[model samples]
Target: MELLQLQYFQVVARLEHMTEAARSLHVTQSSLSKTIQRLEEDLGVPLFDRRGRSLRLNTFGRTFLMRVNKALFELEQGRQEICDLSSPDRGSVELAVNTAGTLPAILKKFRGTQPFVHFHVQMLKVEEMHALLERGEVDFCLSSPPIRGDEIECQVMLLDSILVAVPITHPLCDKRSTTIAELKDETFVGLKRGYPTRDITDRICKSEGFVPKHVYEGDEPARLRALVEAEIGIAFVLESSTWGFREGKMKCIQIEQHDFVREIGLSWHKSRYLSKAAMAFRQIATDYFNS
Candidate 1:
């Protein structure tokens, strides 16, 4: 099959609607349908199942989509390498970060050191960052501990300890330090289920033999702090993340008992070759964190 056919199939598989896919590809619906039909006929397998106006990829299509996506990404990377070779100093780096705390220090240092290099940092979920890395949409990512998966290469950038954030007016505000057990009955604000910090929060609470009485679920640290400042609930966050807080509204107490330390790091696909610009930024990141 032609590369165009694979591109069309990939888009259709992603959108799951021939009409929408056609619109996105700037082609007529009939033409897109015929192209896919020809592709399926040539392969002797149905790629998609039509259900009313919607479409879904069949088992074969799912596998085919993965391969096609990888091929497209590699092709794009090859083109980028050529472009980067021609203008290494002017090339851009796309970096994704899941948390704001670890970003500021690195970004500050990067800006001071590599003022000529362009950076695009997308604040994504940890899982979303991993997906973008796999798709070759981003060159690298910064995320928390327990960096699983065989395809990714991770390096620790910094060590952070968990802290408890409470409204200044709250009773717990008087405490210099606290245990997870002390906060068991307190109304808690937490990151949403899949966040790296949420996993740590859950593990600490579970170890203490109590579940958090969660009142709010915020995915961003800033938003979680807002909820905590409103006296809605107490939140557990990395100590570095408390930099933006004002002393009047919130107080951050160290969680001495939980051993809730996390290592923030940079990750990229091990199989992918780093672009010159990405390599420069990675080195800059390494030095920035180490310093």
Candidate 2:
């Protein structure tokens, strides 16, 4: 029933190991166990199925945990609201990003207007970003192929075309555009699976009846060109990425056969409280991308 008891239970439910949970909470194992026991007694039902030192949430615990998470999130929001009210000019904007291509420009523009407002940016997989959005953990998410749900509000900022990048010496460099089918036999340097560009390009290749044979698989978009330039392999890159490689060592060809444009969007959970600082970032990011 106590706030302390609920907090302890949340940690235990997540870790599922009493000793590990207690260590994380900086409390003794016996004390943490006693707290959970008291909470279960108060509710008149066992929350977790226990075996030795391991714990697993039963049906009742799973249902209660959802409510507990919401309660704690609201309490944390209340605290942030109070702080935001006191200093409207200074606060932090927490953001989860799916693609980092446009971040430099967006953050540079945002900081120009609200220099005092700090940013906490995390580059996450699409699923991880969705999880954070549902939990009200992030102020906003910059995503590709836009996150869609009844509880979320999303606005497309840009329609970025995906292009094929090749070294100047490559045979395909003579053409201004190429089809996905044409690239089937060519070795590619690609972003890892979780990346939006990688996912989109994979589907494009799948639709064309063959997987892209990757000479190298990496997480960094910046290295895609370098890999291609060294004849490691050609790559699928965003149109915006072409700007950095304009010296002529690499050529970015259009995908003429498929309209391979990815929609970049700004998304936020509708139920979460939007602080003034976070709102400012949203407006600035929207304007920057639109312009």
Candidate 3:
């Protein structure tokens, strides 16, 4: 019933362990248990199914947890709004990104204009970015294959060409441009599954009636240059990333197919409120990409 009770419940529901949840909340286990007991009594139903030392959210608990999350989110948004109103020129923007290649330049430009504004950025996978956007947790998401949903407003800011990077000595480098089918037999050095680039390129390969054979699966696309330069495996390189590659070591050949392009965009939950600083950051990002 009390705000403190709801907050404690949220932590407990997330951790699912009394000792761990109590430690996280910085409260004694007995006190946390008493608070949860009081909350369950107030609601006239047990929220979690207990098994010795572990706890699992039951059907009622799952349903109630969703509402609790929304309520807490709204309260936090209200607090942020008040802070923004008091200091319109100085506020934090919580942003999540799928592709990190172009973010540094964009952020540097944003900071140049609004030096006082704070940016809290996270590099997230597509699904993680979507969850944060839907929960009103992030102010905006700069993602490739932009986050899509009925409640989200997504705009494509950059259409980066996806190119196949091969070692300078490789046979493919002899051609000016190549198609996905031609690279089907080549060993690929790609980002792991769940990455937007990996997913987008994977789909393109699938449509070409072949699956890419990945010799090295990594998290950073920049590292692909080293692997390709060593002639270990070729990679699908974003056009933006080709800037860092040494020219004579590797060649980034254009994907002749039209579908082999990455769509990088900014997305946000349409219902979520954007502060002055967040809005300014959004505008700066749009202009930076467009220019």
Candidate 4:
């Protein structure tokens, strides 16, 4: 079968609508239908069951679609590999992280070796990272509270403890360690509920029999730390996050009663393309954390 037929089939299987798939493929409905028919004839079984304007993958279609996806992914990766071999010094690496502030040192270290490499980094909520990886949209994802999926592989770079940051004037500032139980009633300044940090914080607090009262929930770390600096509320922050707040009266207290840890890791799809620059960046990221 032609590669175009396999590509069309993949898109049709995903959209499941003849008109939409045809539009997306920039081909006519009849042409698309004819392509599928030819593919089925070559395969000796119908791949989809037509339902008016929509199509559903039959049992055979489902099995064949999986293999088709893998084949397409590999072909795309091979095409990239051929293109990337010509330009080793100047390549782009697309990476996603749950938080932006966590990667400066690691990125700086990676850039040290590959000065010509460019980064296309995005700060995404952890929930969205897996989908980005699965679709091959990003070469790497530094996920926190690491994602679990058979389609991707993740390596734990570090286990960062979630610490409590409080204003010096607060009662717990002088304490060396505290518990979620002690801080249950305390209001928190953190990211919104969809973030891995927020989710982990809520889970840990729930284990202590209470939920956090978020005084503020926004995407920026500066806001979270600023709120704590103003004594507006305490924050559940990473141990590394407290470094910026350390210059002031903010105290980063360890959570002694619970592990209160987050697993930050490097993740990529099992089948996604990785250029030389991307692979180098990945190795540096892995080494930077492990060292």
In order, candidate lDDTs are 0.82, 0.88, 0.88, 0.84
Counting clashing residue pairs in each candidate, in order, gives: 0, 0, 0, 0
lDDT ranking of the models: 3, 2, 4, 1
Tally clashing residue pairs in candidate 2.
0
Stretches off by above 4 angstroms in model 3 are 207-209, 243-246
TM-score of each: 0.80, 0.91, 0.88, 0.82
Candidate 3: tens digits of C-alpha lDDT, residues 210-238: 99999899887768888988999999878
RMSD of each: 3.4, 2.1, 2.4, 3.2
Model 1, 258-277: lDDT tens per residue?
57887788888776667777
- RMSD of model 1 against the true structure: 3.4
Candidate 4 weakest ten by summed lDDT: 240-249
Error of 2 at 161 (Å): 0.8
Q: Stretches of candidate 4 above 4 Å error?
A: 17-38, 41-44, 90-92, 104-112, 115-119, 122-128, 131-138, 148-151, 247-249, 270-273
Specify the poorest-scoring 10-residue window by lDDT in model 1.
Answer: 143-152
Choose the strongest candidate by TM-score. 2
Decoy 1 TM-score against native: 0.80
For model 3, give the 10-residue run with minimal summed lDDT: 237-246
Task: Give candidate 4's whole-model lDDT.
Answer: 0.84
For candidate 2, the per-residue lDDT at 26 reads 97
